[model samples]
Target: MANFKKGVALVLAAATAFTFAPVANLAPVTASAAATQIADATDLNLVLGETKSIKIKDISAYSIQNYTVSSSNKNVAYVTTTTTTGAAVSADGATTGASLTFNYSQVGKTFDIYAAGNGTAVITLTANNTNGAVVTETFNVSVNDKIEHISVKKTSDNSELSTAKPLTIASTDIKATPAASIKTNVTATVANRAGTTLKAVSDDPTIVTVANGTGNTFDITPVKIGSTTVTVTDTDAQDKILASYTFAVTVARADETLKVTYDSNRDGKNEDYKADSTNGHSKQGNAVYLDDDKTSFQIVAESALGRKITYTSSNPNAVSVDNNGLVVVSDKVKQETTVQHISADISVKTEATKIGTTTVPAAEVVVPVHFVNKKYTTLSVADAEGNVIAQTVNSPVDLADTNKDSKIDASDDAVITLSTKDKTSVNLVVASNAGDNFVSGEVFAPATNGKIGTTKSDVVTYANGVLTVAKTDITTDTRAFLVLEAKPSTATYGANAKITLQILVTTKNANNVIDVAKTLDLNASTKTATIAAKATYGNILKYELVEADATQADGYKAVAGNSNTDLSVNASTGLVTYKSKNSGSQVVRITGTSNATAVAPKAAYVTVNYSVKKNASDLAVAAKSIILEEGKTAAIGATASTAITYVSSDESVATVAADGTVTAVKAGSAEITVKAASDDKFDEGVVTIPVVVSKKAENTVVPKPAKVTGVKVANVKGAKVKVSFKKVSKAAGY
Candidate 1:
């Protein structure tokens, strides 16, 4: 194997030697090779803006240096660089602060600038000790703008110290120029102190005012020079006062002083006076003086000294104040307020007159009164004090215990006419303080001077305006008052009315009788009673009666249930017993009477205890039993209550009638039964009666033949009688 391997190696070495011998022969090149020998001829001398490729013949690797590109002069003057191997000018050329920078590597290279848009520039690149050589290049680039934009908003309420809210003033522009000056009203022109004319755009001065204080001076023409209180008011479009100033006018005065007296304590007096010399005070708010040249003084009103400010005036007048420098008005025609400011005097005057007027029409009122039972009731007329000054009384009356105190006496009159004038109409509602003693009615013409005006004849009629009174609801526990109201037309409403009426709610105790009471059991016999009695409220006496009695009592009497059984009652106490029969339930009708006749009939029912005895007769024998043959029949009968029933002991022997009768038909024992009546008394008891039957009988005898008859006899037809008899007849008995 070793010998074979050596031979093969020898053959491989010879083949390799042959393969390289031709390439070494073809290039014959050495270290003295030309540039064109290292790279392609056309690829040599590369342009400044182009890339080039280097190639070698036969040799696989080599190096190049000192490659260059010349510009402007051909003294081999080229873009400078360190001579090295395998370097070249990039497509963008070398970098400069003014242009782009070079970035080169063994295989790749590039150029860049901090920004884009570099102009064309000549540059060079030298290769290192590598096969590739140096090159030259030139390039240009365009740039794009890339600035960042940002925004921010204010944090506060979106306001700055330098900015101001727009201002508006009534009757003028905020420039303080008159509106009429904007048009044809030249005489009313507003001029500035600096010899400038204020321009305005408005036309009507009465409709608007303008502010011109931007320069602190303004002028108004066509006005009298003497001092006059000019009420200048400054307000925003919404009538809100942001700031206001008041000043005096002079021929040359630029600054004006506004004087004010303030009640610091609001005690109805001016405690201080302030002067504003730089600007006028705002009437809409606190007034102040701000002129640097003038001294601001304080003044106090006389009332500030804690002394009562008194004003003397005519009768029927009054005065007051709000304690805030507001003077209380009085009946005085003129009023004055005084104060001291800066060792000087100040006063304000105001005129006063009646606010309105009032008048009272002439009128009268008529009051109506009602009473009942002649039982002393009172009516009264009173002032606002509730005191009865005028009063009258109806005769004796009992108002009943309205308070339930068990007493009914009171002191007053039931009717009265009060005399008064010029009053307001009021309704003194007739309220029953004791029992139902009062009722409501209309009181007409209260404001008329005792002259009852038109009367309402229906509900309340007054012919020719004359007052007439009528009574309503008089019986039972009742009382009333006639409210008279006179409303004055002059007085203010709610204060114009006057109430004066008589409280005729007089009550007195009187005698009365309630009906009597009774009771009964239903088992007792039915019966009735007559009740008759009469009662009166006062002195009147009455009588009554009802008749025909089983029993009589002081207050009632028992009677038959007949036509006259109804009760007739006395005037005092009615006969409070029966007017009806005691039908288990009895009704005792009590007829009440007053003034000798029956008034009202009242009834009460009681029960009566009653019972009934049910007696029934025993079933009676109507007829005796009849004899019959065996084939015939006979019957026994009895009579009893319609409801009685009959039964037979043996139907084969005899049958009984429905009325307790029995019949015999066969020869046997029998019985008759009669039950108690079948009315509701079936539950009482049943009765039964027995019946008998006899049978009739007849006798017969027979004899028989023996041994002689022993002979067989098949047929024997009435031939002969065979007798096995010991016929021993004792002498002539046959």
Candidate 2:
């Protein structure tokens, strides 16, 4: 019994030792190691230039005070200075990028992170402890370099379509209007993150097609009138679709400013319309001309979109026109040496009324034709051009605007008006079929009625027809009749043709002013500008370059006949180029003569104040405002001579790349700024482009629970109780 008792006691002691052996070191109860976590980051996948927000929940022993966010590569994954809790602030400082906003210090402080570029980044949310140890939570950001937007530009102008707007090509009736001016090729641009080269494919080749060009540009040729999408993909990414752009080839129509061109050379084409020929297009201001024998010639629109041309005559008794543009002249032209005219009304009819006379073409599609008689006269008094100011008669005292165009032009006869009743002498150049002998002989001075208004006197004496318009015996509104006897020896007249002149002298008239509009800039791309000057009452001012000597080259003298190399003036076109640089301000004088020689007898001047200083040209941008939805992108239309850098004011809202591509992040506003680096030829320029970011139209809906089977109430204490339920798929909140 004693030994049994001892064994029992020993077992009991061993059991006791095992049961309460201080249970201390087996393992401490660790509650699964609670962690400091980011509640929103399951996986950090971001598009380049995109921004996202994260929350760092203060769990376990991690405190919220003195906590800061940082990125490993600020260029790739960047942190912003803005914050909701105002935890920390920085620029492109040691710990943060110069972008984004984050709210810190709260239990779950929000952290705004930006995928500024393409690459991987390690972002850490660190909390400082009293001890040297620290609590840190990290997120690895993966950014995909890809395309975001695609657009087109006119190769001639470099202007781009609006953001999200399709590249539209107006209709071209090419088959019907072969001479139509339409450009089919356009340059395409892809706004990308890492500038990965992309290939473009049109959904329908019959609508449009894309051909890859240099760099990130492509050539898109419109084929027809329809809408097609150009799918852009990264071939290096195994043909992954990056973005898509739309091309809407809209229907073509005739130009608003319709013009009817005369095919004067008896051909069905406008190849004979000389521009200074082969200079380019037809003389945009070509005067009307008709070959008397040039019947059956065509008259059509310089540019038409399947429209018809209709012809009618103002005076069918003088000249008649057919709908097919056939002109017939009648024998009503009695003046052999003088020029005469008959108005012809031409218009474009909407119906493709077969180029023949079946329908009447009227308003809606018509442009009032400004025409003059295309003539080769036997006798005329004109300027350097054959624009006859006065022609020898069989004229019925032609002093009025015969065409009733309100202004004095070539269609009007010459009437000398004196600014004052002073004895002013002038010269006249008579161009006639009469040889030099008849031009100098006693062919002029004789009057048919043998009087100046029933009185005989030398009110105006004629010496050589080239000079001597003597104003010794002149009065107000004086009329003189001078008859010329065309001698057979010198005159090209038929048998006994006589040319008569009805010279009228008038008094001073008010409102004789020349309105001058000139542009003078030395450092402009187009140093030359055609002076837009107008005379009183719409008389076209004739331009001439005045001559200057070598000494007065820069004397601001006229740039004609002179040896001035610093300037050039096109006599034909009043286009003046100011090429002088490093020179101080000088006045360039150009001859501004008026066509109303009777009113403006003396010469006039158009002065351009040429003050040119050589300086660097400033950079420029075409767009004023940029607006887009979240995740949408656009490009800044900035032009510069050197490399450009871009920055966004609020990277959380929008971000711009080095190439001026802008990406919208969240719903907010930002300023995208472009900076052009300074070089020898260009000044450093900075322009701020405003951007408005709108929330995307996408709606995210959480799913409803299928059944509330496990839902129950728990932890009932006082007035509060806890409710528990099974987590449902995609159920966001309780």
Candidate 3:
């Protein structure tokens, strides 16, 4: 029986070792040998009001007799245990009607650790094994406030406020005529603490007030015109003074009184009222010109805070006031026969007191206004020299209708047309001219509606009439008597007349005396010239053949050798042509006759002169041959009554210019020819000259020559004399 019992005990021991050893190898547990092993559990790190579950494991291969759970800081963190039977046990270690029971079946049980507040707590689990061994397990649990970040920002824009710098609220100007007020909202950001409320309080409520219970936002208003401080803190952590932000606020005082002024002219200057009892009108220092488009007066205030000014007009029909304190004279006042004086009241009130209970007195002033006529006149046309061009008794010059409307108006004042002679320019000037009631020192123009406009005038151009005549040379026979007759001679000449021609006898040669029996009448006004026709024995138009020389003294005949084929006589056209047979001057009388008897005919004569040229001869040159060195130029001496052309026979040796200057080309001889140009009075001639060019002399230094002691005359004849002198060595040729 002992052997059998020993065998059973050994088997039971092996079974226990095998069962518990595998469990221990699965998960390592730590505890005293006699105590129940507790599996290692992760520490709890949680936020406020958060819970974590820790699983309990037994690795000792022993049954758990009982278990108890407790927390070191119950207010910060709490612990509860659940047995394998599903019975819940609180930190005091009691279950529903009994104590917690634990064994191998409760190895997988769990203990729940809850975070009650922001602090650290240790949860201890004690379990006693059925073999009388006890094991304790502990876990550190941390509870943190849910807030992850904190910041302050403006509620309106959500802009973060700076913590490093004190927040400053802009001040208000309470002393201003109208006191200024300002307010703003600020909110705090508590991330992960969405339902938490923040509190904001001002250090000095007298200067600034912060409204509370407005969620995360607080309203900050300026209480008085001074400075104060405000602090914001988290209500949840009220005792944590380090987590608070303080800001500074300031309030400014504004001016107490507003200065108001009346600028009747709106020239930025105050005007004084002037009462005129006699005229039943009052003037505001200066007159408001009725001619100006802007005749309204303005009232201005000194302070922009209380700039609102009320303007009232006494006479609504004659004047009106606008919201901007501008007093405008009505059109009815402008159309009045006499000047009208207008009155207006301007008032401005000061700002309310600090408590908003009392009202400050307002400033009021009455301004008198006056209207005056701005006398102006129209524009007058003138020349560029400032000479006024107006209508006169003899000459009625009207202003130009520039628009072509056939009416003189304002648009025409800029430019005007004036009559001018050909090839001449006249400035059509326009200048300000005073009218019946002109105002001194005031400019006037047509476009200005009797107001000041252009101070200078512009110019316009007018073209002149051109005149031309049609006529050709006369070719006729010498024997025929040519009589010029004017066709359509009854025209006139003047500013509106056609151009006319006048003829007269300008010259008569010594040999001939032609008779003109009728008196020539040339009238420019009639555009006519006339010569009477003869009847019976009277010859009003006469042409007598005159001799050019004694050889043909009886009567000159046409020369057959004349090359002029256009010379002929046409008696029907009154055209005559004569070629002299001898070299002498002759005169012929030609009379012009008008087709109409009322038109006077003009008379004009012609004188014929001829000359005979000498026969051709050889051209002569001053020198037959010229000698020049290389690189030298000389003039070929030749003269003629007519123009002469020069030519070089050999340009390689020498060149001759048109003006007869000859340049030596090299050491050689050349022949230069001179020929006279064709002329009616001189015959053509030709001459030739020989030019010899020698080598240029070399430049060399020579000893000074002896000076001449005396000069003796060997022979003298008229202006020629032979002089002798002593010879010197190295002398240059003279």
lDDT of 1 at 295: 22
Question: Model 1 residue 77 lDDT?
Answer: 19
Give Cα-based local distance difference scores for all models: 0.28, 0.46, 0.44
587-676: candidate 1 lDDT, tens digit per residue: 334333332222222233322222232334445654444455444444445555556666776787877666444556768776666665
Candidate 3 achieves a global lDDT of 0.44
Q: Residues 397-505, candidate 2, lDDT per residue (tens digit)?
A: 2212123212323233444332333423334556555454544322232234433233433445555553233544444444444444333242232232234445544
Q: Which of candidates 1 and 3 is the stronger one according to lDDT?
A: 3
Clashes of 1: 122
Error of 1 at 95 (Å): 99
Worst 10 residues of 2 by lDDT: 1-10
TM-score of each: 0.15, 0.26, 0.19
Q: Count the backbone clashes (under 3 Å) in each candidate.
A: 122, 10, 22
lDDT of 3 by residue, 1-734 (tens): 10111110111111100011122222223444344435445455554554556666654354444445567777777765554467565653233223443345445756566667667876655544444555555567776432211122222211143243232333222221222234566655554443334677887887677897566677776654456666776534444332355655555433223444554333334644422222222223333322223457665544322222455666666667675666677777666655343443333332221212223233334454544322212333444566554311100011122222223233332222111122122333332323212211211122334222333212121222111111112121001000111111112100111111111111111112224433322111111222223422222453333324323312244333222432333333333343333344434335333222211122334443333434354456777788999989998778777788999989989999988899998999989989986554356888889899999989987666578756788658788889887776666532
